[model samples]
Target: MDIKLDAAALEAFLRAEFPQVAGEYTVDRLTEDGLVLRMDVAERHLRPGGTVSGPAMFSLADVALYLAILSRIGPQALAVTTNCAIDFMRKPAAEGSMTAEARLLKLGRVLAVGDVLLRSDGQAAPVARASLTYSIPPAA
Candidate 1:
């Protein structure tokens, strides 16, 4: 379960691959067990009710799990999300950043599965939970 991409590695990968979100996310920690990624939320992440939107949260969940999988398999950009299921359990803090903790459940040659727990900064309970399956492409 050792990470293929640590905090620094994830950051560098983001810069090289997805520059659009590089400034929005920060990798907090990565280890053999899991990875912790923090989202630097802005006013744009909120919606009409001052709650984080589903898409915004989903993106975090998706990317968090994706990064976690990559941390184990290395930078495989073609490793794409094949399936995802998420539960929106609670509303996040209106004006704060959020954190996503992701762990790989199974990593196979062609598919990787992981779960993500997302919470507003400093919150005790997760605002959302997600499970994702990624399709890993053949090494090229």
Candidate 2:
């Protein structure tokens, strides 16, 4: 699919449309079929064991997929996640950032499906994986 937004445009869209989470994530790059997003890990994202929390990782995956969809469909803020399933395979590193690589599996007229793999920076293996389905609002 053709990309409607680049990295800079996606970042601007996030800041303008969703300022609450704009600072938490960065658009690392936009690939042909997807994009890579980096989450700046903070103290609040940690669990009791000094590892990244599941919710935080889930947020990363969700936002990554959301942006991936927007990159193709333009800034459609109403596009919502209809279903999501995530698997936490291993513990993430305590320090540094986590990157989520999200790719769209299918982009139909009303629904988009994607998968995301999250890994701690510098790690070779993924810490988590997620599959998500998003409902795209019909054009006005």
Candidate 3:
């Protein structure tokens, strides 16, 4: 699918629509596989074990897939996650920010399905993997 929004446009859309989380993530690159998003890890993102929290990683996966769909479908903030399943495979580096690579597997009229792989910056193995399904609101 053709990209409807580049990195700058996507970032702007997120900042405009989801200001609460826009600053936590950066639109790193948009590639053929999909969009790559980096989550800026802060103390709040860490768990007691000195690793990134599961929710933090899940957020990266969720947002990454959301942006991947928006990249193809335009900025549709109403698109909401309908279902999600995540697998935590490894511990993320506490000091390094995490990155999520999201690929759109299917984009239908009312639903979009995608998968995401997350890793701590510079890590070879994925820290988590997720498959997400989103319900896209009908165009107004």
RMSD of each predicted structure: 1.1, 0.6, 0.9
Q: After superposition, how far is residue 127 of candidate 1 from its true place, in Å?
A: 0.5
Residue pairs with backbone atoms closer than 3 Å in model 2 (clashes): none
Candidate 2 regions with alpha-carbon error over 4 angstroms: none
- The residue-by-residue lDDT of candidate 3 on 59-97, one tens digit each, is 999999999999999988899999999999987899868
lDDT of 2 by residue, 86-125 (tens): 9999889989999999999999989999999999977899
State every prediction's TM-score relative to the real structure.
Answer: 0.95, 0.98, 0.97
* lDDT of every predicted structure (CA atoms): 0.87, 0.96, 0.92
Candidate 2 vs candidate 3, TM-score winner: 2
Q: Which runs of model 3 end up more than 4 angstroms from their true locations? A: none
Measured on C-alpha atoms, candidate 1 has an lDDT of 0.87
- Number of backbone clashes in candidate 3: 0
Per-residue error for 86 in candidate 1, Å, reads 0.8
> lDDT (0-100) at residue 22 of candidate 3?
83
Instruction: Give the winner by TM-score.
Output: 2
Q: Write the per-residue lDDT of candidate 1 for residues 1-140, one digit (tens) a residue.
A: 76667778878998999998878888888857568888877788989978888999999999898888888888887889999999999879887799999988899999988899999987899999999999999987
